[model samples]
Target: MPVPDAPVTGAHRETPEPPGGDRPSRLDPAIAARLRRTPDGLVAAVVRQHDSGEVLMVAWMDDEALHRTLTTGRATYWSRSRREYWVKGATSGHHQYVRSVALDCDGDAVLVSVDQVGAACHTGHRTCFFTELPVSSGEVAS
Candidate 1:
């Protein structure tokens, strides 16, 4: 079935041209159609550990990637550099199984809760925030 030219809130109306075609029927038409993307065609997804509430990583998600994640029950993101869709744990043994997703007030950012297995950071760390930046007081956050 041909997807309708629905009205999308914030920014221009997406042509409903999801990368892999129409979004799965399981996803609400209104909610799935309302995804807001930057001019560069991306939104921010913040991944956090479901149990410990520790931040795992932040990644970009275009409309298609977001749909992929919602439909597949896995954390999927758009690779800005590589220009591709990547499913978490596709390559590495580390995988983030989506537990819940929360949209920010602006609806542009998302907080994804996941049952993470192995390391969340590609560098083999539990989280990507292992490094701390020094504050104006010349003291780093502990």
Candidate 2:
């Protein structure tokens, strides 16, 4: 599928209120049609710092979570372990103010650009990817 350069919500029509209890999705049909969900019905969300291009964290998002993020301009994710929806910064003061959101060419992942404040990791790291893996080359790849 040839994905548009525009964000998924760029031309989305306002739908009824988001999904209620146990409801699967309230995502716009157009957007939903473009997604390629996992067996558990989710897409990977890669969050990054807008200005610095620093990857902050990775999370999952179901259709409803995506809808809430798009509509609210906050980073909302489906907590796989917790099995619930959580908006970033809701509990922690570390907030991700959304700058933009775009689906990958494969429709299986999304890139969320945001103005991140405070720690973006559960361990209080600025980013979730703190530990660097040992590389055989030990040199930056050009």
Candidate 3:
């Protein structure tokens, strides 16, 4: 299926188009290339907290999600269970502002350093994985 043209947003929309009648928005070519390579497959993003260096979450990014994150300077992800692009903390108050973004060696994964406002987990924990299972005992503990 053909993808629709992405909607223009922010002050750029008010600016006049180039001589060509339409100007492409500022998105990293490398990121775009990675998205195109993946198609509908998974692209993992390792979400890290800026101050503590904690890995808050690992979310997937679709083309739209990656575009939104780059354009808005916020964290966005493609939710496999929901089957949609979801802006981080859109409904919740725990928004994540992008500090920096990087692609992995194979270009199939991403690392996003962010300023996480509140809990990254839905369960009110600071991180998604609240409890860890002990390998030796095979017991789950917080």
Candidate 4:
């Protein structure tokens, strides 16, 4: 378990601990209590198109990113590569307007349903998962 005062490694900005020092995060207490984060303090967020049920992308969210997404009704993510917080389509103009957010049963991942305005994939595809993976054809044993 991480210490309450330890800085989140990839967060864009670190929030100073309040005087009492018992609070583990700046995220809403209710939401924070449910999250099971990676060692780097991130949760997997699987974004999907609300109408088509097409999975758009998978992103990472720290507590702050999740909080921002919840409060703003926009998709926000913590970019591991960029080491920053990025609002979806902020640069590409392909926005994801959040419809709903759900935490998975294990509390390790979140499902983000959104109204995707344009291409969800950065490569101009509809979704990030465009390649088909072949499966072995086999009969089930009865």
- TM-score for each of the candidates: 0.74, 0.80, 0.70, 0.81
Q: What's the lDDT for candidate 1? A: 0.73
Better of 3 and 4 by lDDT: 4
Q: State which candidate has the highest TM-score.
A: 4
Report the C-alpha lDDT of model 1 over 1-142, residue by residue, as the tens digit. 2221121223232353345433233446676556676766677999999999999999988766776688788888766554556777776768889999888888789899999988888778889899998867676778
Candidate 2, residues 19-74, lDDT tens digits: the string is: 33233677899999998988777899999999999999999988888998999999
What shift in Å separates residue 122 of candidate 2 from its native position after superposition? 0.8
Candidate 3: list runs displaced more than 4 Å: 1-29, 35-39, 137-142
TM-score, candidate number 3 = 0.70
Ranking by lDDT: 2, 4, 1, 3
Say which candidate scores most in lDDT.
Answer: 2
Candidate 4 off by > 4 Å:
1-25
Candidate 3 per-residue lDDT over residues 8-69, each given as its tens digit: 22322333333321224245666666543344455789999987899998888765567778
Model 1 error, position 115 (Å):
0.6
What is the lDDT of every predicted structure here?
0.73, 0.80, 0.68, 0.78
Instruction: Name the better of 2 and 3 by lDDT.
Output: 2
RMSD of each: 10.3, 10.3, 10.0, 8.3
